[model samples]
Target: MSEFKMEHKNPEGLFVSKAFSQAITVSGKAKTIYIGGQNATNSKGELIGAGDLELQTKQALNNIATILASENASFANLVKLNIYLLSGCDPRIGYKAFQEVAGLLENPPLVTVLFVSEFARPACLLEIDGIAVIEDKD
Candidate 1:
């Protein structure tokens, strides 16, 4: 596992715990893996969380994690993350979910959570996509 740590240069920053700099930069040669939008459902095609942003966010992360694992990637290896959210929500609601999701990762990845008018199916409060790069370890 890579030694992933959060940087806190601006201690008085507004979003203190919610800000970070990505660990992996252009300096290293890493393998790339792109994970598609993952929602709060599992392989069984059932919704893990209903009508709840926090629960759904957790499930979405788990769903994304599975995809990453299949490709030999971990949150620590993530270079970018894209979060897609259903329309009928306060932006703060999505931000809250995102804050939790970021905390779950070993290190915060470059992220942009977009609020969309609709998703593949409704009732999904959040969907997450990930791009990761792991060193060759050679």
Candidate 2:
């Protein structure tokens, strides 16, 4: 059995959705993973969605998923997500794309979205970083 306990919450007066939780509480002995900001770059370090916010968001999320998989973890173990978007990018576009992927998880993680002027790569439209908690096997 896993030693991790995670709870998602959307308190009164807060909007709710399968794609995200307003708050997340985690307890018990677990291994926490902090993932760096993932961009819309492919394995060859080339940008995937140059000027499309939605497409870039999807690619960034996919990158994060691939990184998590390397550690034997999945979106189900994610507790928090921080999304960064290009200053002029529409957040709704990114949100829609994110929902398409995050909705696959049984419980969504808490999230914060921010708009920034630029990124490490000029063509990057967005980036996503995450924190995940997995049961300690040892």
Candidate 3:
């Protein structure tokens, strides 16, 4: 059995949808994991998507998913996500990819997307970081 309980809510005046929740509350004995910004780099450290925002977003989210899996968690355990996109990239492109990959979760986590002029790697078009809560069933 899981050791944590999650409640996702859209406040009285807020819009509702499977894409995301206005807020997510987590309770119980849980372990929190802070994931650093992930980019479109493969295991060999090669950039997966150079000028494509959608591809980069997908790769970055894939990286985060891998990290979450390492701790026995999945997108369902995510409480928050922070996305960074290159200035010229259309936010819609990245968001569309995100929803396709993350919208399947029973409770999508809160998200904050930002536009930045550049990143550590010039070729990087998008990056994503997140926080997840795992039920410590010990």
Number of the top TM-score candidate: 3
Ranking according to TM-score, highest score first: 3, 2, 1
lDDT value for candidate 1? 0.69
Selected candidate, larger TM-score, 1 vs 3: 3
**Candidate 2's residue-wise lDDT over 45-125, tens digit each?**
888878888778888888888988888888888999999888888888987887787666668888898889988788898
Worst 10 residues of 1 by lDDT: 2-11
Query: What TM-score number comes out for model 3?
Result: 0.91
Q: Report the Cα RMSD per candidate.
A: 4.5, 1.7, 1.6
lDDT of 3 by residue, 14-92 (tens): 8997767899888988889999999999889999977888888888988998999999988988999898888878888
Badly placed stretches (over 4 Å) of model 3 are 1-3
Worst 10 residues of 2 by lDDT: 98-107
Report the lDDT tens digits of candidate 1 across residue range 41-138. Answer: 87899987788877888788877778778878767667777888777666566556656654555456777768788766677888888887766555
Clash counts for the predictions, in order = 0, 0, 0
TM-score of each: 0.71, 0.89, 0.91
Off by over 4 Å in 2: none
Index of the highest-lDDT prediction? 3
Worst 10 residues of 3 by lDDT: 97-106
Query: Between prediction 2 and prediction 3, which has the larger TM-score?
Result: 3
